[model samples]
Target chain A: MAMSTASRVRRQLPTSPWLFAAPGLLIIGAFILYPFVSTLVNAFTDRRTLIPGRFVGLANFRELLQDDMFWVGLRNSTLYVVGVVPALVVLPLLLALLVQKNIPGITFFRSAFYTPVVASIVVVGLIWVWLLDERGLVNSLLETIGVGRVGFLSDQWLLLLSAMAVTVWKGLGYYMIIYLAALANVPRELHEAAAVDGAGAIRRFLTVTVPAVRSTMVLVGALSSVAAFKVFSEVYLMAGPSGGPAGEDTTLVMLVQRTGTGLTGRVGYASAISVVVFVVTVALMLLVLRADRRDES
Target chain B: MSVMEKVRPTASRPRTDAREPRVTDENGRRVRVGELVLRYLLLLAVLALTVGPFVWQLSTSLKGPTEDIFSSPPKFLPGDPTLHNYERVADTIPVWDYALNSLKVAAANVATNCVGSALAGYALARLRYRGRRAATLAFVLAMLVPVEGIIIAQFTTMRELGLNNTLIGVVLPGCVSALNVLLMRNAFLNLPYEIEEAAYVDGANVWQRFLRIAVPSVKGTLAVVAIFAFMGAWDDFLWPLIVLSDPSKFTLTIGLNYLHGTFANDERLVAAGTIIAVAPLIALFACLQRYFFRGVGEGAVKG
Candidate 1:
């Protein structure tokens, strides 16, 4: 059957296969692959938005070292990963366990919990912006409770922290679903055995469930860390386009947008920052995966 | 009760009372009433955390201008519910146009991803061709290259092609996403080869077999791709913000940002704008949640 199928599939016109793959290949090559290569090339050149630039080697990288905004951007982006990844990893697992049982109306609760995931980040960002506004629900509630109105969007560290919280909030449902799938695959016997051995819920979770989904937790760590590193829209929307007070809340991607756009936009410099982003994202992924591997060993 | 009977719900006699239906876990073990109550409390708390903000936004949007939105002890519900804010949002910006633009981009994204990925995926999976591995590799590599990193170059590419500020430019870069192509490839690869072999033997061409046989089998995956494409395009902020310079061409996300930026003073207007932007997606998600959850599971496992 294999031999016959292979022969039959080969009988089709040679051009037909290329035709089938043409549109996808063309678009991905043009927009994704080609631009990726150009980002590498353009990183070395002093290209502006309008002016085609000549290769200037590592001047952009050297400039990045001296650029204060670049450092601010790096600091904030790194802080974002630190602030967001752990909460994303642990909280969602708990949420998944909470929703895992097939209680009546459990499906509705699952979907409802996932509502934030479905909404656009812009909407989510804006919603939180208002909610965290000094005159908004959070502050209003706070003031009523005698804590007084705290400015969530004004202070630099607080702004970054708030953005991280929003990132975690929006992401909770997404990672919850991922953990739910992972939890479903955990053997009932392992859990039952643990319970029989006099393990409480927390003990069972640590011994049986944690070990079972440890790899998934690693996967979540890797995925969320990478995403958190590329953090833009949440901070962008919450902090406004200028990226909060004195641009202290600027993320790497935000810096890229701010620098790399407009007629006078420093395309080369932005690409250089982008290169840094790419390198760090790759490193974060490797770091998480290596940690998982080390644990296995 | 015997120990065995206490442990097993089935071994015990069924309850005669119909008023309170027995609640069982996935394993069909009856949960204790205390535990069930505790679970409900946790579920409701999480529900409020997750779904509460959107409700707050909706309520704010509905509140009339006369109502104090910023009153201490923030009003959860509008004292006088009205569509006045929605009207003001439209009056302030060409929000309907922006929404239309978003719809156009999202619809185009869905169509292109569905058609383009299906064809590419079918070819990669079903066709025995040279360089198929390289083509597949190209997509994998493309998928790995994050869009945030490539925006400057993509913007240049769009400018060079004179596509910047156009909806086409906004839609082009992601119209046939490599991830969707790979997803479709996996879907096609999972089908039994014998079915296609029969079609080939019956003289159905590759295209015919793909359309009539292969495509139908993977409608679930296709729907998944479509939903994600629409959501991705609609919810996208940075790419559209970068690609589109003209206010007329701004998608809903960019427009919301504009609205928020210009009208930050009025929470009511901004709230209305967000509601307009998010309501359709929430509705879409509500209607197709089963597929959405299935997609999430499949995508996560595959990832």
Candidate 2:
């Protein structure tokens, strides 16, 4: 029986890899790949709103390049990618390191920090809206501290800042977990060796600790960057229908939603934005993948 | 070196050599004091920003109906807290029905995503298959590309299948979470193959082997997938909003969203309903925090 099984495996390993992969492959093709290609192709056509319209040419792309809203959306997304991604990357690592201690009641603090990450984006946004309202606790706290009230959600600059703040807050627990898992993989023996060498704490961290978790850092950073691009519900909840004060908090995803479903209703126009978002995200990923792969080799 | 100096590292230098005596110098003594204060201050800032809102929300939920929520110096602590808002919220919507509906959809969704993830992940990790890597990467890439177009198409598909406004409608769309697939696959790949082979040698079937061996080994990953699946399904609003326009069939999420307009945006009622809707997730999360940690860290936006 064992011999027969061994022979069967030998035969199967060589020729059957593709055959076993069909069902899932088909779903991927139908749902993911096809939609992506169709979306890009549809971008070039003249689709009237949510209705089925005819194909036009590069006119959609031309309009996308010329439209001022598209530019604003692009610039805001860029700021978010720059602002939120790094904070998501850094703050979480710091928190994980802090909470990794075995101090009394530290577990409770860890649990509290992570609770927000599990909450829905809409819920978080709604809470943040109340928190940022003119007479909100944030302002009250500021007033108590003798700082005059400043609009956290209304001023355009502060709105983007608040959006990023919420983005960071929701993500802090998540990235901390990533950083925790990554930290777990660092062998205890290495730390002991660094300790034996009279290496100061900073020296040990820089030389041994940081290097061990480099892969995780790359992986976590890249994933968070992509997440920042897909950020939708937060903006929807905070900014209401238009993406936030003066559209400053609008992300690439919000723009796609607005163009696809709302008064704009231009399917081709929205498809063009989708294509652009798709490209931008792909570009961000390629950059990270290339850098990480290069580091690996 | 002084005893206090030997414990905490200076702020500018965060590294604490587990073995080496902590760094100390005559001129740097005052500098260390300032750095220590700054580090604690920054950590305090993080705590205040992150947990402060929940405290305020709790306070607001306790406020009376006519109490000014949008006030001059927004009352952090209501002068008089009451359960009147909670009572009204319970009256406004069938809270139990909404809760049950949410549980039903969320549980069914989690079960489907789990079984789907297990089968798909098993096939990807162990079964000899054609274009497996490419297929896996395709799913990963799909997640990266915008799904706005597909939502409309999903709506169209649901309409065509007569699945709209049904629990199955929500569960079907969630059946194949690609990120869950990647997580399970990565977990399975890391597991020792010898266990499965030993089961194979004993004439155990593939499904039995998976149940006995692979499943037990990847319990952590499964827990992670289950938690996120429940959270994602329970909190989903857009699909339910788009598919079911009827209030009777509404999920808890849609009902909470409805609370605002239903009560004419009465601040207290909305606050009460929002508090009710968000409370369980926060509670469930507190009970099962580790799974969420694993899921978030395991989130894959890569191909």
Candidate 3:
């Protein structure tokens, strides 16, 4: 047998590299790679439960096209992304601007804000459920101010708004910390120069600070949208797993879970729905990346 | 100490802008003072908004069952504070068992990620290999793939492996975080190549060089990875819920969710369970905040 090109490259490359990457690659292969490929194949079949079913090419996708729940989930997820991303991105930048300054008790404020982020989503949901309950503290405060009780969790529209508020509240400090790190890299002289040129604090922020942190703004935008799109646990805990009344709060992930694990047990159909979820989320990310590049150029 | 140093401004040096008294003294001082006051007020408002809910929950958890948690113009403080709800929570659920399960999953994740990711990252950064670019791109794409999208398949995988309902199954999928791999890779890339080359010249094999040289050099990044892995495993709810059917195998999050579902009427007890679940994570974050904040930027800035 002749020495082959593969053998030549194998000899050239250190085998220790493979030794090093083996454990990581093995686990990722078994878990992520295998599951991803299985999900892809599963989308084409009628597989459900532990029993493997026969292939039904594109049938799941076909049914999904006409599925009303799928469309509702798509709409709700989009609405969630639209409702939450702006505040999650913009408010953090403003908050970072406030806390980035070296002042007394700044760390205390930082920790206080970050406390929510540290808590699990379950805990966050529990606390928010209590806070926004019909006869809860918020309602009591509103009553004291002579306003009627708002059904934050009961009313569908208010439920959606409350979910967004909870997400924004939890995320504000996390993104603020990211922006704080970015703010440190922005040279101080730019602000001083702007000040020397008679620009006020707000003017300095608008002209100098915002522009410097624009990339982080893009980052925050992308991250928050991804998070918003994957809005399951919040809706699950706040609303029920049936995604509240009329399925108004159901995101695509919820739909996938409902189809796969719900009474239906249609794993293939759920896999098909997840394929859509993957496509749409990756598309959203690409759209942001492309827009960011366009802005840069 | 470094966090404190960063937060403290150098006020020891006296002002030297007296020559520009008209510009620096009059308008600047007034405007700065006004801005400072406004900033403090707005920041305090945000602080109250962020921490106020937790405070309310803590109070609610501490209150007696007959205190009327729903009282209008709700009391911020518990008048007759008690640990009755906490006792109820402990009585109701296997809180300690769930906590022990969570700790096992989190510790396993930290160990696996720190060791596996460091090895892979070192190889990718320092060792010559075929398909290195492909490997790196795979990790990046792996990160962008939504976990829920493949969750059904992941469940099937766990079942196939006979690891279902086991803590190992819960920890395996997340053992090597793509983010940490990238973080460690970045940390390794920033290291001076000369040291590794010298070790090689001194007859050190790749493993020896990696262990003695590269691993020691990236302790900070390792700490970051460890914390990230710990928090991720600690905070996970969905995967564990999917994998572990047995309540005995349940993590704290699942236990709390169980409490929420079963004890829907008992708000204070549920609140107590929530606190039990969250308090450790908050304490961990407090201890490792410097590394946590730095880790967030380390990944992002390099990207």
> In terms of lDDT, which candidate is strongest?
1
Fraction of the true interface contacts (Cα pairs closer than 8 Å across chains) found in each model: 0.93, 0.26, 0.64
Looking at model 3 chain A, report the run of 10 residues with the lowest lDDT sum: A1-10
lDDT of 2 at B213: 91
List model 1 lDDT by residue over A77-97, tens digit each: 999999999999999999999
| Candidate 1 per-residue C-alpha lDDT over B238-274 given as tens digits, one digit per residue, 9 for 90 to 100 | 9999998899888989999999998889999999999
lDDT of 2 by residue, B142-176 (tens): 55555544554454445557886777776666656
Better of 2 and 3 by TM-score: 3
lDDT of 2 at A291: 89
Candidate 2 C-alpha lDDT tens digits along A1-297: 768887877675554445434444554555456656767777888765446668788889899888888887888888888988878767787787666644435567777777777776666777877777777767876887889788886787788778888888888887787787777778766775787789997898788877887877787778878777767766666666576666766776677766665334566777788877778877887888898899878
Stretches of model 3 off by over 4 angstroms after superposition: A1-14, A262-264, B1-31
Q: Which candidate is the best by TM-score?
A: 1
Docking class of 3: medium
Which docking class does model 1 fall in? medium
TM-score, chain B, each candidate: 0.95, 0.83, 0.88
Ten-residue stretch with the least lDDT total in model 2 chain B: B22-31
Report RMSD for candidate 2. 6.5
